[model samples]
Target: MTILHLALADDWTAAVDAGEYRVSTLGRTLAQEGFIHACADLEQLRGVAGRYYGEVTEPLVVLAIDEELVGCPVVREIPEGAQEAFPHIYGPLPVSAVVQVTPFRR
Candidate 1:
């Protein structure tokens, strides 16, 4: 059960410096949608990047999160009757939860 999140290099750096990372798309807070968005696996991650960040040219990074170190709840969400689910964090993600950070380039 590996879940990942894509973040701009600078954003991730800032999060590490601040000790927390918040969802960026919707007001940069969990209150906007109640969770921090994430992808279930590589394929799903690529799809999300293609769909929403295709035009992005800035350096990016793939954050590999260790759920137990998250310091908060991690949930998998799918629509009613849907088979595929996405991973989301119920609160801000601490830098410690991210076990690995890899450069993301298309």
Candidate 2:
């Protein structure tokens, strides 16, 4: 299965150089958030982007991650006050697990 993560272009580049991704979301680190948030589909991703990243001006990229290539655990759980379940990575995401990185348009 593939999970998608929306990342800042700079952060993605940093991760590429560092060999692993540690950011959990926009301004939060994995150590602070405990898990990296991901979306199961494009529709869900759009909702998340609109709700959380709408005001951001920085360039963003969408990371298409191959679940099988990820060494850490991927769990599907509903966040508080939310009905839909989203994929959450339990540990740092390895760059090797990312199958594709596309510039985000919206």
Candidate 3:
């Protein structure tokens, strides 16, 4: 199964720049499957994450991933001072907060 990740952007422009997620050979091998990345705005991601996590909540990014890949999406949030990664989460994120969305395959 393929696992996809959705990381939220700081703003609308960031969303556009985020574009689609891609997986290289190394990434594919690491994931042990395919991967895709997507971007969504805070409000939109909030709605999706709200429904996912139950009740209304805000998330930095809403990740759409497959069941098999749920536990191992391969890619995760980059730590501070490790060189900013694309589709990075900006602003403050709560410790209790995570914005992974259910797989919405098209």
- Tell me, by TM-score, which candidate is best: 2
Question: Per-candidate TM vs. native?
Answer: 0.86, 0.98, 0.21
Q: List candidate 3 segments past 4 Å from native.
A: 1-33, 55-106
Candidate 2, residues 45-72: lDDT per residue as tens digits? Answer: 9999999999999999999999998898
Of the two candidates 2 and 3, the one with more favorable lDDT, higher being better, is 2
Candidate No. with top lDDT: 2
lDDT of each structure? 0.82, 0.96, 0.33
When 1 and 3 are scored with lDDT, the better candidate is 1
Candidate 3, run of 10 with poorest lDDT: 88-97
Per-residue CA lDDT of candidate 3, range 1-106, in tens?
Answer: 3223334333322334544232322123213433333223344434434444353233333444333323333344433553423232222222223335443321
Stretches of model 1 off by over 4 angstroms after superposition: 24-28, 79-83
Of 1 and 2, the candidate ahead on lDDT is: 2
Error of 3 at 81 (Å): 38
Worst 10 residues of 2 by lDDT: 65-74
Clashes of 1: 0
lDDT of 1: 0.82
